[model samples]
Target chain A: MKRTASPSFAIYTPDSSLRQPLRLVGAMFRDLSSGRELAWRLAVRDISAQYRQAALGLLWAFALPVANALIWLFANASGVVLIRDTEMPYPNYVFTGTMLWAIFLEAANAPLQLTTAAKPMLAKINFPREAIIVSGIYQTLFNAAIKVVVLLPALLFLGVQPSGYLFLLPVAVMTLVFAGTAVGLFLTPVGLLYTDIGKTFPLAMQFMMYLTPVVFPIPAQGIAATIFRINPVTPLIQTARAWLTGSLGTDLVAFGLVNLGTVLVLFLMWVIYRAAMPILIEKMSAS
Target chain B: MSDPLIKVENVSKKFCRSLKRSLWYGMQDLGSELLGRRHGDNSQLRTDEFWAVRDVNFELGRGECLGLIGRNGAGKTTLLRMLNGLIKPDTGRIEMRGRVGALIALGAGFNPVLTGRENVYINAAVLGLTKAETGRHFDEIVAFAELEAAIDSPVQTYSSGMTVRLGFAIATTLQPEILILDEVLAVGDANFRHKCYHRINKLMTDAAVILVSHNMDAIAQTASSLALMDGGAMTVFHEPVEGIAAYHDANAQRQATTSDGGTTHQCYAPVVAAEVRILPAEVGYQGQLTVEAEITCDADLPEILISFTATNAYEQAVMCWHSSRHPSPLGLCKGRQLLRFSVAPLLLDNGSYHWNFKITRRGSLEHVVWLTRHGPLVVKSRHRTLGNIPYLPDASQCEHRMLTSP
Candidate 1:
């Protein structure tokens, strides 16, 4: 039989009805509002469940990054890796940098974590899937909230003066979040299909961190320095570091350009997610 | 009837057999969507792929209950998933006007580390309930699940039955406009199943329900109308009983045609053909079975063993009788001959059974022919209300026995 539809009922098919780009953009705004409440609920669910069985509970959120920071501090002190000199105490610098990077890591990992946890629901339930994405991000931010507790005290202990452009820190941190999440959202469809993406992503992120100015300042000159300069994330990380330590870098223009590029990439990825998520969910579940 | 709350029109879905091709197809589908290109003809079967659901059509109006009865791989789950909007139809459309809640997989959304109460709230929100709504109904849900004491415990600590009870309670209490249940009732105990049926009946007063289950009695009891699904296509029946009977008929056909593979023993004798027919279509408890067979042989045979084996619903052989085991043996004529045998009442269980008829040479591996699945025998129970009563219990027939006196 041929396709048939009544005026009262909306039809669904493998082929999505062609919608204008403007309509899709409008739908995203509408979806965000509708999905926000559920996202908060899911975030609460995730946070409670994450620590329900653990003895240390939410402390692990702070503990994990602090532990990594200490390991790096010792390595630099013993001259194991020889991180470049900085004006601030190296431990505090490493801790602050780690904190910012942790937020970026959370944002980058949000899409994969959300889709994996929601796979069963995706197969059976038909609720707003955007809620999963929003919840994942909210959970990331919630974990980062605990990091702020340590951050304020560490800055005081290190005796570092605040930058006059300290208010711009939010803008810098947001750029890191957006850039990381844009890359993650772009990988979500691929990750759901080929689990190789999930297994290899953490290793890839670890490698990319070396290219960014996460643990050390960008080198002055060398092949590695050139690679770091070309890296988009280097400006974002350095900008946040510069804002936190009261040392404004000369790469403010590059940082602004990177933020602008991150926004555009995020918008493109959001559009791709809207178009591709349902198809990916369907295929993943059926397989 | 008022306009259907859920309208499903000629919905079809395709699935690939190989994992590699399935992933490739997924990528291609996603690429097409990004490019705003229409999907290619999915109705045309590709290599290593077939339609899981094909040209299925149905409508569910408010206050209506529709039952989907089929065997495994019959596409009922696929159809329900499409209606729930978990997936889109490959060829057609499914449109619903109201919020749809599906219990396609029980405990599917539960997080093991979350408390039962917490899981219920999240599950309610997943079904579109707000936080305030979930809070308002939290006690009611826990009460319905009878998990008051254990509601605070992590879901991982609860048994499978408790998990399903919680899942069911949340879905039903949410009072969705359209409810889709798929084999969920099979997991819980009898008491919970009864409660579920009661809740579903109450839900159908306002919302439409689509139920897919293997239990014929449940379908017959609950469905306002029924749909039979076989090999992906759907045929709706006006009467639930008729739909159930058609399901059994289709199952019988499926049973008879399934390949048994190459035979280990072959008959050297030249045999033309064989036919078997049951004397009566329906047999009651302790009723005589008269099996008639007509076999044509090229040469006269000394004695041919005519045997029939009756197997229960579980495919367990309940009875085996052969002409050679009889007190007096019989011989077949040279040409076509009709033979009839009257045996004692089988006294087997009261359920559907398959009677397999076979012809073989006496005391030899050589065989004439074999009909693996001859036909179904609907055996009636002495207790008219009971179905599938295996054997008469060895208990005393007395209604009451005094074990102790005050």
Candidate 2:
């Protein structure tokens, strides 16, 4: 067959046909987003996979929040600690923050976690990248959900009294859940902009773990505390603790509102990520 | 600047890579030093220096198979990466008008944890095969790769050869408008490589193929025209045959130019090692070449037996000749040694062939002091074209074998 090059020239014009490609891209994402059910299943699979390969198994999961709480208990038992002497035992205070923000961020980080680790999978395989992220996040959520449900009775036995504010804790937790998820959503797409974001994530988490009240309380309105609250997660952490220990009072509403505001920020990022995903992956795939 | 399906105008790329830490604690020491800001430590962006592919330009028309030829570190891969848009050029622009599919590095996109099937789907999609298109061609791909049994298994379990084979299968199945194959065919056995190149050649219905490979014969056979790339520049652009010749010449000259040119003709040794040709016997025309060698040296020279061997384009030997000890009285010193054997040049049908020579000490052919491959001896045939003869049975076998006596 005689194959010849199409030789021609013309002025550039707006290509409506280009829009057809966007439609295709949209269809692809729809196909991707359509896998919500699959996403959940993959998350469960990931959770099982992590815990399955360990001799300690799921004990480690329980151990993480509980042991973390016991350390606070021991530290407070020394009475050198500040917030516990004010009233609440240190474990309950720490557990409240850990339950609300720590668990959620930890779960959210899952989706973005091996984002670098699963990089080989992303580069080499055909699975949905977002699905992998969502799966990991979901697995984290499952872990968090189990930890909290199991901790509720112990929480009361530990001399932590429950008031109506404890009911508001779920709302506080959901807000943080979506807020942390939005961070994950933002991280994956922006990560395409820089090569080292994945490497620095755990470090960023270390800073956040300290900045938020997972271990100690930072009273509201101090200058240093405000800097720590710079992460929208701080308020959510404080809110979760307050609700569980009946200390939320009026700030719980404000914390939920801030989380909702962060969601809008995520919405904007979601748009940018959607725009950049194909182009980024395309650049990565070239020989 | 003119309208080409792919316009590569002064396009070049350089990557900034931190040298891999050769020792443990290398990064830790560096980090601590940097954080401490030790006195007189001139850490002046040593990590950020540039390794560049300079300005290179080439354009591809539709249905064009442009060969890219170069020595190692000659910027051919850098140029290919630019065209494929894998990495952006450090300077200049590469403008293309259609979907570009690059099988740049084989299995560069395959995920080992995923099943072969899942990889096929996503890999195809990334390679510009849409979801539906990937689904449609999936079976043909599996069949071609001959991996039906293991399609559902994770690719990590596969051998490197199998991974490459499956990759080539998937990439070629696209039959893309523009197919960028970068040394991908180097994988697999010779028989399979032939099948792959043949399949790829047949797929030139309307596809523009840009092939980068180390095999000149392959480039000559598969590509329409060749583009020779050197240190960040286009050296020669021509038809495949001529390109192959120029490449050989350039490489020979490169070795010659870079070396201490003491033996003015030491550079010419490989080219002029032997006078060889193949021509037809009819009408005073020698069409096929039969190479016979003669070894003449001083009697004082170590007693040696000279053997001659012939290899076809595939590097397979078709014929060989060995010369026994020369009569000691012939005065081996300062005399022309002629080891002459002739073929009617009938068996070597077509394509390039290399003549290999071996010189060994007396009584031991294994003591090879000299070995060389005479590259690119083309056998021009007129009357017949025999494609890859496997066995040469005796001609008498076909004539009434039933009455044969032991």
Candidate 3:
């Protein structure tokens, strides 16, 4: 009786959907809500399938950040390059930085990764497109959780004291995730269309890491310091590391402003993604 | 009549021939959408662009199955995609009232490393079913797929047919009010196919269905009305018989132009020239028919086998005659050879037909020299028959007897 009384109805037209802003936003929210269960199922499926065959399993998630930390420690110890004195031990500082950066990188890459993996289904099934985005977030959060589990113990073992500020670590880590996801979501439409984006994304992220105080402390006064201060990633990562190490020099104001900006930009990118999906799917299916 | 559940109005979508151009155009279109600008006159095509589905219109009420019959690349899938809301049409509007379920790509998102049990839940979720709903249908889905024993095994271990069966089962379990199917019936074994059709028939009682399939029998059995698509355009036929006829005529015409005179195999003994002639160019039902073929050979051959297949107007092979099965064997020398084949009392119903001839070496099934799609062999009959081959016995062979009532 309910099904007959209120059968779902949908209309698709060539007219610009942006012309109907209210409807567009309404549909977006509706799909996002309806897509949650599907997104969770997909995330579970992907996470299980990903590590099932890999002998390394969850170690693969830890592999990247740990290896990066090891590489930087080796470089710092061998005096291969001059480094600024960190407020915390170099090992602890770089370890926390790389761990946080890995979370950011995973968040940044999740949108495109999940989307590309689901391209076949995207072209064929008429499911809520937002499910892919939500699935990406689920996976990102899952991976971030794993990295945090590894980080907390490793940080304490490395002589860093957990402080009262530790309660804010999740907020800081989420802000970084939000910022990274915003950038990734913004690029998803074009990235889906072109191979060049996927190919060059890693190199671009690596270059950005050097500017974000991931491998080295921010230069006291120089062109590098100017760049680091100007980089939006700086405050987010620095605050997350400070929260973990109980440091007093956290830029809370800049971090909050960056978080606010990330929210606005993420929403804007989501709208763009929603609008561009049909065209992208058509192009993808056609080719 | 019930209110129409699906209505499509003058929908058209353009695609670029070159991938580069298509991506570039996609970027431009995305920019316009982002800027809130109207998609600049969709009627006009840019360079390297052409309309994939042009000006298609249709409406389907509940309980109606609209069969889409067309050659490959005839925009049937494109139109279906638009109706499924997977992609937007560049030019018109599509209104779908009620939940839309698509079997366009069964098992589309199946992860091979996951077990069939897991994949079913994922697939059902993708079709818009909740986890609890999938759980409720889990046993039925597995039973329908006949994979109860292997359902726990990883999908990678299952055969392709098993996977398809699982996909079909999960997709159909949703029972949405609008179903979009694209060539899904072409898979699975005959028994499973029968089950799929039976399920679809049940689903059709309360749903609007759009089925795109090349299988004519399936179309005729399922569709209430048929839409024949050609060159991105459509002609609707309320009568399935007329639509199938038009489809066959179109097929015959296209085959005539593009036969390529059969693909000539460059074997050691190649057929240089070949000609086939019927004893009587015009054949009548239940008449003795004789066929003669002259094949010129380039080299001497020890033993050759010739086979003849006669296909009716619907492209269904009605009769087959092979030479190797006969008592005598024929050989070819380094010259033109005349091969004669005769059939007595042809039982084919009145219709136009084509003959396909194949010449192969003895002991080998591969065609050494093949001449295909040779004729419009017209057969006429005094009394009309119902099916392809009429059961007409010769008068001398027929006997009538009167029995006492018991």
Candidate 4:
């Protein structure tokens, strides 16, 4: 049989992919495009399977943020802790904060979770590995969409009027996703190799939430305020919350800067992931 | 043959013995990869490291199947993984052209919580088929797997056989240009297995196929050439029969060395010495084939039954004879005894056959002595038949008449 026009072929060698920067990037882009359909299929499969067995179904997506908001509301209302005054009602403030935080957390955890789940497939099949990462992004977007839909209705229920900047809310939420997915993709290689990263990741995210303006307002002139100002998540969360609540307290410049840095880091980590996967798969299969 | 579709050159891979060290080395390799530094001098092994596959080279063109036969841990899987591009070789290069499909693990990406229909789509996607493509083939896959009734049921609810059937159906329907099958046919019932072989034979005509299996029958049926891998090294055989023979010879040698102390069960009535002689070394069809055995018994067993079994090259017992089934049972005294077993018309096809002798107590059926003699008595036939056993009627008794004209 004659060879097909533009027959697909691949060469595997010990030479580092980094040695061929242009080709590596080209292949990455190619795989990214080709992997889109697969990503959608996997995402659909995962989402269907995930909710199929759940008794509460989509409510589970709201469970974490709602529970978080209630705990803080209880703490504030019961005088167990004193929180500073905010421009909006404390309930609105904490609820929006917790919802956006959940989006960020889910985005950050998606890559590792999906990749770890697909380890067996990755070791056996030779399809574009980038599909897993794309699938993770798809799932995160699906989850973030759910939270945003819930947040918009809840904001109106809490007496906050929809503002003209409501369209910008998606942008802010996507920036948060970008930053979170970047961190997650960066940690995925090591996280897959070691349980230490997967174990300590949630704890670190929890601690980071405290440093960010998640539930409580940023403190007034203290070490806590300095940490909040310096934390990259601070601008993302503050911007998202401000846009959601229709407030003019958005940190546009810092958000832009953080997103720019995030794109660069995300791309770099993607390359690292592509380079490290074969080695990781080899080791994983050996064990 | 057309230009080679798969070319592998001096490919080798190393593995670490200790898990901890393996992880550590993995990290180091990742670091080097990230730094854009080529693997420096990986030909030498570090501490606790050994070569899993070493210096293996072969090229395969279209319409050829290479049967890779090896013992466990001989690196057949490692080599296949490299060829499939799941992992990279540490010291060599592999060039694979066309779409390569690997049935390394059936139902590899299957999620048990999902229905069979859902998993089929997901598995097809993972194997590089678009959703539209999968949709087109969905009904055929379901029909082939015979899961039309339970296609909507979760895969976890399906039996292992059902799942494997679904997996095999989806994997084979893609019709890739290069197919790698690793013991995937070693499952399912006899009927399904036959169907799978038929499908594989159809796929082999246009694809460059690499099959890794321990079953000699499978290799003999599918492969045009063979590769014998032992201890990370490979020896290529142009002929499938020669490769099967080498594999059997290697296995026999290994068994012989391992069983140096003998496989005798208890100290009861043991056969001290035995010799088996075939009357005619090369027997033709419908000829008299006789097996005579001279036995030296250490103890008297008055009611022992002796049985002789002839096994073919595929390790299938083709024929057996038992003294207990005869008009009178045979016994062993405390001395040398000669026993002769004969078949007036051997109906076995052309192949090599080995003999197995067993002596058991008549009533209790307790094994008195058991021995396997690898005589490999040759059977030659001018008339070739499709199956193992051929029907050879007496010349005067057999008559044929054509009822219809073509």
Candidate 5:
């Protein structure tokens, strides 16, 4: 038997009293970030399990976008006989929007859930909280990459040439990805606290769909439509549409600025969740 | 000077319920109550808002296994969580000087869809074990769980016993510096239970285990110093056995004073515990023949069936049960009753046997009142074994079968 070290009591005071909310936010961030790495490990399992025995393999990722684009095409064709009209090819129009929408939907959603999903990890080990959020982000990004790759072949099949605006798709996609994720991150504390936020999230997302400019066009002069433009995803979907169609919108700068603006909002939300996440987690896990 | 491994000072935690505590707390809401009540959300708290665990203070020297003993909801688990940094008390603070490894939830991270191998790593990672650390320890954990080949199978395929085994193995294997356990070693069979106790003793060399359990016997056996939590504060912290005595004292006191039927919450069927007893039987004979059982139970109008069997230390039954059945619509009542079970002719070989006590409906033999266990009854039947055997009606009536050349 060997005694390594004798006990010495130190009276070092811990600066534990930072405004409760801020302290909570800081802890939340740490938990999320550390949790993100842990989540990455878990998501690797989730991703593999999702596609492992599927017949279509990785085609599972692109299948949604393809199905959506086909629905758009079929609807547009049926419109003439049904006495409704669309001038430009609606299939291409929906494809452009679907590309960005798919990424936003995936990224925003993955983090919105399992605030309690990370409960075991939080309770068992201490890690940064963002790890869980970022793991969700990575999973979404994986799906987004699939959607992006599928875009190229479709663009060629549609006889569309690459326009200068095509270069902007990545930038716009990045904005949607980050902005959606940030909103999801912002909801973490509330989700963990009330759980109402999680259970009711699908309903809220459905309402948000109407506000976003995915299905309909927003005329430049409309005041109501302008408000919708501020919805982070507006410019993201708009930019992707303009690029894929080889036609540039008049508000490329406004669109780019809006896309950039979401980063700040996302960052602020990140800070809030980072700060609030820990205390809420502490509350969540207290026996 | 080296710092002690943990610091918990003046930490207090309380849970506030949603205005449903009692009809009495509402009387404090009038003009008289206004002078007593605080502002805003504090009033929303009612009297239940503050489960005052105030000014509680303690520190853990490195490698100190502090035992926390308490009644249900005594803030023992709450304190353990705080030490592990799982919860922050509204007042005061707790600081751990080393990596905290706690089992807040034993099977919390196990995914039913994943194989046991996958869950072990996932759960280990959550408990701060890196990939390499988990890899090195994985085989040992699987072997310890006695699920070597079964590790590859999904956890859902395993029985509840297997699930608890795997969870216990995974949680215990992580080399925690400050280990916190909450009533998780309360499962497993007798031999495995002994094995776990030994493993826990070994772990005490490096890590300080802050263990919370309802088993006072285990607390007595394992703990060095005990902290008895009552209400929300530490009412007693002393020797392990002393703390257990205090707990029993508190429990017995609470039992004697209460008269309301509302106190009895957990029971099945129509039977309720109005009385319990343990007594020495043989009012007529002194030491002519020896048998003893320290029985304890709760029952009201219980049609009780009692069974007693003597066995060796291996728990192999050397003789059959001596049973007595309480008659139906019995001469029992809804008040205190003391029943004793001791009879002549100590009837078994030398060793220990546990008295398994159960009370059930004598009619269908289905409805149960309460059940309990007692005594590793020691039998020194060295010369008394033959004298103890009761005469069976037919010792030579049964036929033996042979699978040999017929």
Candidate 6:
């Protein structure tokens, strides 16, 4: 339904209404549709700036994760960390899993990185601030596309044929992004105030990867398996892998609940972000 | 008319000096917003916090300009930010009818690593332009900045003037209905600054402009109304001249109270009656400016310097005269002293001006009495001047000047 603002002009204050969640959702939809060109421009700026004067440029995007997956593969093969057998080749399995994890990581980092980078602009210009987030997501997706270029070729070389459930890959990726960004949006305000979160996020994410079954199969009965079950990202990563291979996961209920929880939590995060952004911006600029 | 295009009502903003307390307060504010609680009174400031802008009320109609002038941290920039929607006020509201274009800082959104051409696109987008819109005006923007040769070069390589030119060009392209300009003339060369003033004058016919500048001349030339801000409070003057006078008075008072010599030393102000008169009615005919003052001092004083500064209507210095420049030392004594001064063959064109008078210690910078905008002097013009500027030089001097004399 098309919604019209009762008052065309807006009055803003530090203590203004958060607006109804429904109204915020409506505004987000409006900005996404109308401000698409601006978002595209901002994304293009980031991509061009990121690649300019660089020797390797965009290749570094895929190269980093490829190196990461290779380390785990070598560890398992050397019997340093024994891995459970999988239906697909271990290299292809690890590659896709690590590549998907990278996407989540980028999505999780987008809010803080984009907001920090745009601080000066935000303090002076008054455009739709949400364009920053939209542009950030677009940049993250572009980076993921670079990773897919290598991931696709690796899958083909490993002779892993595409499965019917491969069509669900986009949905699975969406769930991962939504879940990751939900936590990111919730923490963005805190990160804006304290630099510690931004400084330690990469290290924290590295440790978090071990708790999820990214390279190895989930053990049936062990402390590792219990951690995997409890971890919020487990269902997302497992389901994405199941879709990539022909084998579907055993627990459909867990997948549904995780997806549902992700959507709810993401909506809540959007509410918090909308309410806190102005206050955060005012404080950040003053300091 | 038709309700003002911009209305700022009792707007206030508070700022905290401590980062930790600011963050905590922000979180608490956010929680209150989520819970739909009423905002507490913002006029009362807590420790480590102060109101950046308080109870600022004003309105602007279409085609009107409001000039904001204040010392640093008086909340002029903060008020502009609120009007531009970059920051929300802590109390009251700012309502406006159309798009707001702000050039609050030069090169504010430009990426240093990006070429000027690329930065133009991003900055236009940041100012609310679509990709196609920016593309359509791309050539014009570059032309306006006069940076066609350097368009492909990285912005970091550009000089500060070049950066400001490009930023101004991009920001003004939208011709927004409500434009907020903050200290844009603080950079750029004289020629470009004049061009900017001309361009802004063109935009003034249809837009409501909120201008914050330290250049008194810029304010007086462009603004129909003026606001004087101090300590987070604002007083608006509908008449441009009155506003300028109030600004000068406040500024003089502030200087008197804060200057080390003025505040620390014991001194007395000699009462004086001052008046300024222009001779021959019109300029360009060897007109003269005369100033007369009757000074009465309680006790005899030696070695006092009496100085006069002539400022144009915009409060820019046109000329200065000092008794100390003479071979004989000017002195003050008990009872009354009558002083008369005249500058014959005044070079000023037809204009209204304010005369600033100062009495200081002969050898030191210490001001005994500083009277700002003491009186008005009016000079009429019978014939047009040689050039656009008010200063007029002798015809023989202008005519005899050789093209390659150097």
Best by TM-score: 3
What are the RMSD figures for all models against the true structure? 9.2, 10.7, 3.5, 5.1, 10.3, 9.1
Query: Candidate 1 on B1-406: residue-level lDDT in tens?
Result: 8988888777788888898999988898788788887654536877888888988888889988899988888888778777766676778767787666666655556788888887887787776667777788889889989999999898999998899888888777656677787777644788877888788777667778888887776777889999999889999998998898888777666655766421122234566767778877578777888888877778877876878888765445777788877777667667898988875676776677777777877778776877764457777766433444346545676678789999
Quote the TM-score that chain A achieves in each candidate: 0.89, 0.76, 0.95, 0.95, 0.78, 0.89
Better of 2 and 3 by DockQ: 3
Q: What is the DockQ for all candidates, taken in turn?
A: 0.34, 0.08, 0.59, 0.44, 0.17, 0.29
Query: Considering summed lDDT, which 10 consecutive residues are worst modelled in model 4 chain A?
Result: A1-10
lDDT of 6 by residue, B1-406 (tens): 8778898888888888897888887777777777765443435776789888889899998889999998889998878877776666778978887666665655556878899999998887777777777888999889989999999999989998899899888877776677787776434788887788777766666888888888776788889999999999999999976887887778757656774412222235553433333343344435776667666777766888887776874557777788867788877777777778877766666766666777787778887666676445666666455422555555564346568865
Best-to-worst DockQ order? 3, 4, 1, 6, 5, 2
Residue-wise lDDT of candidate 5 within B149-190, one digit each (tens)?
Answer: 799888889989888888777777755567677777645788
Mind giving the per-residue lDDT tens digits that candidate 1 earns over A114-157? Answer: 88878877777766677878887777777776776667678867
Global local distance difference test of model 5: 0.61
Please, what are the lDDT tens digits per residue for candidate 6 over residues A1-287?
01121123656654545545566677666655665766888899888888885789988778878898999899989999877676567887798889889888889999889889888877776667677777877888888778766676678777777778877777877777778788788778778877888998889898888888777767688888798889888888888877776567665678789999998998787776766677677875632
Worst 10 residues of 4 chain B by lDDT: B260-269
* Candidate 1 vs candidate 6, DockQ winner: 1
- Candidate order, TM-score descending: 3, 4, 6, 1, 5, 2
lDDT of 3 by residue, A13-67 (tens): 8877899999999888988888888899999999999999899999988888999
Model 5, A183-222: lDDT tens digits are: 7877766666666778887788767765666554564457
- Predicted structure with the largest DockQ when compared to the true one: 3
Q: Model 2: per-residue lDDT, tens digit, B1-406? A: 2346777665544433443321112233323322432211232223543334665666677778888887887777656655554333445666766555566545544666677887776556434455566777889889888899999888888988788888888767655566677776645888778888777776655667788888766687778778887765775466677876777777657646765321211112112233333332221123334554444333333455655665764446766655653344121233344544454434544455556566555554354335455544555544343434523324564554567767
Candidate 4 residues B1-406, lDDT tens each? Answer: 7779999999999888999898888888889888887752558898999999999999999999999998999999999988888787888899998888776778878889999989998888877787777888899999989999999999999999999999999888767788898887645899988888888777778899999888887788889899999988999999998998898888778867885422333324466777667789889877888878787888877777877777875677887777867788687788998988787688777777876777778888577666675566788877766645665655686669999989
Chain B TM-score against the true chain B, candidate 6: 0.67
Score candidate 1 by DockQ.
Answer: 0.34
